[model samples]
Target: MGVCGMLRVVQTGIGGLDVYDVQTCPVPKPAIGEILIRTEFAGINYLDVLMRRGEYTSTPKLPFTPGCGIVGTVVELGSSVNGQSGFAVGDRVVVLTQSGGYSQYVTADARAATHVPEGVPSDKAVCCVSSYVAAHQLLHRAARVHGGWRVLVHSAAGGVGTALTQLARIAGCAVYGTASAGKHDTVRGLGAVPIDYRSSDFVVEMSRNEPDGIDAVFDPIGGEHWLRSRRVVRRGGIVVGYGMRTIRTAARMLVASRGRRFSYYSMNTRNVLQNTEDLRLILNLCSENIIDPVIGPRLPLERVHDAHRLLTDGAITGKALLDCR
Candidate 1:
């Protein structure tokens, strides 16, 4: 915890988490036009899970720290970085780091970081970069959802789901959300028509309720769920596939249900390529404010294992966060 030393969670090459105690590396010296941050909080996302499992299409080299979004106070600035350019030494900010968020400190391109408003807590700001920004990008820009549109969002109680539902409602769209039965009320409270994905055929239910069909479907649960989504969306209605949660779940379930006789890799590579394009649409929603991500259970840095357990167990309602300070 000394100024000259740092504590970081390192990913072992074998796909395990290990905490390393090292002399705080010199506060990452900011390069020209960069800023150093004393991180206060970090957002743990599903991408982090994929990164850990070595399942993501692109993986960082081994032994790297994993954290994508962070909120902190600026501590140092590079000479080419203007302290007065809408920021100062003490400014509260959130950064979209490609990595390095699991540590106590970070250095990032000044342009990729944004100053937080006065009233928003650092934790909330942390949500903005990944969850909120992603939600905004997907719903408004990618989907082009608008008033009177009928939308269906998978994982409604989740971070991205919650954000999309809220923003859709704000845009005057009617939203239907899928979640476990236990989370239905939570989704309803957010102003979405809730569908219990565990017990219902969402496509059938939506068809029964709105036969004209949905205008857009926000599906992070890819794989088989993609087919189900297609059924609910009207022709020309877009289905945005951002995550492989459904595919991963299907793979695990296939192993459990068939007792080692099934493999989930039968899907074609063309499908994967198309799915990535769907994700790009979600990213475009960020600047439009349509998908605002929801903040879920938060844990201190020391409890990272607990956070991982909660996420893996499907017990959290939204994105989990690591309070790094």
Candidate 2:
């Protein structure tokens, strides 16, 4: 509040990062179709961690703040930005941003934000962008899952995984999920049949259970997992690949080998090209309620490095959050 300053978590141009304090850039003034928000919570995503490590495809120039979405109260509104954007000063809103969310204040294009319904916690609304939207898109759009279908979701206890499982069940599909052994029960509790990804060949197990194979596979892990995913789906069944956790794993291994031969650019480009529809479908699903994101551990803005380490290490389930305020 002093001098209208805002605190933000910024990348320091190093591989992994530590926080730096910058006086709030002059409080962003709203232009037409824009609104200023005092952010209450920001969603931390795997993409953020990847960006911090210089591994994500869409890395921002260094010394930038990292946060993708926010749940906040509108503090100022520009002329021509009102009911059409569905917000006004004092309105509770959730905004999606490519970056710049880990701050005390944000200026958003009104069209890109949603008003949070009464009774929804700010923390929960933060999940709508990354987790819920991803889940909704994967099941309803990419996979075209419907009643009577059988679906398989990987990392079932995690954010997108859990959302997909719940949404699939709501849509009357039989849901199966793969996770670490320790998370199987949690997956099952969410109405998914849990498969232990570590101890089992999921493709073989799924085939044995469904016999006809599953109608779709929602996978964020690529690399060798895609081979198995292809096998688990019935003929023409869709495999929606959103993240490349497997590729990241492989990349890390390649970093350790002096003569490792592979082009990160080529591989990532191919991966993105192949998954364009999948991402489009994810976006569509968010406009509807087929999937709802599961919020995970919430950390303060300054501890973003710890958040990244937790995500990379898979130490936490679901999506991690940054309470920017």
Candidate 3:
């Protein structure tokens, strides 16, 4: 603890998550147009890992905290916080903190923070802030998929993949998802035709079946995987790369071996920013039981290392949550 009142936080002075250490820092004060939040849970994502590793396109400076989305209670209101926005003390809200979310408390812009709908748990609501919105934008904004369209989704068992599959199905599209053989059934349950990428070549399987190719391909696996993904799309079809796990892998390997430099920065999430309409739609869907967040595991704050490892290794299905409270 510090001499002054402070909060416990997980911070990284170096580029890797291995450098993460606990420290007591003065609790941040909410500034104008901001709200102080007591973090109940923080949503971890591939972006968090990239940000931590200093490989992401937009990363924080050194000695930083890395977490993308957070669900918490508004503890204090900033002076310029407008009452017309409907935010109040004690309201349960979700904030999309591009950084500084891996902590006991965080401050967020009032306009960007949204109240969680009743009945949605903090763990799941956390996904809606980024993961669900990512899927939403990929399908609707990037691809403009329509009813009866044939869509392909990579990593179909993961958070954004599951969201993409379900959203495509809801849009009346026929989804073809690529995943490991073990996750085939789970992908099928999400209303997608599962392609076993481990045992079979997805490009050949998809291309041979659909001679015209697919309407859209949502690939989080960048690098060579991105090249394959682009091939599965028709001339006019779209290929949207959200997370570049594969590209980041090669970049890490290059750095470790002191080899040629590689960049996976092009596949970051700048294209899938915040959308108020999509947030409202997601929350409404949760309330009506139309769309549900598929959570993989809930790890305590201390298990953050395990959480990141599990996500990086593809050892778990669905979204992972960090229990900060």
**Per-residue accuracy of model 2 over 164-244 as CA lDDT, tens digit each:** 788788889989999888877778888899998788788779888988777777767766565567677676566666777
Query: Would you list the C-alpha lDDT of every candidate in the order shown?
Result: 0.71, 0.70, 0.77
2 or 3, greater by lDDT:
3
Model 1: how far residue 148 lies from native, Å: 0.7
Residues 208-278 of candidate 1 have per-residue lDDT tens digits of 98897777788777767766776777755767767786475433342223111211221122232333343
Query: Which parts of model 1 have CA positions greater than 4 angstroms off?
Result: 14-26, 248-293
- On residues 159-272, what C-alpha lDDT tens digit does candidate 3 reach at each position? 888888888999999999988888888899999999999889999999887988777777777766666676677766666666676564432332212221222223233332
TM-score of each: 0.82, 0.81, 0.87
Error of 1 at 183 (Å): 1.9
Off by over 4 Å in 2: 1-3, 18-26, 82-85, 248-293
RMSD (Å) of each candidate, 1 decimal: 7.5, 6.8, 5.9
For candidate 1, the per-residue lDDT at 198 reads 77
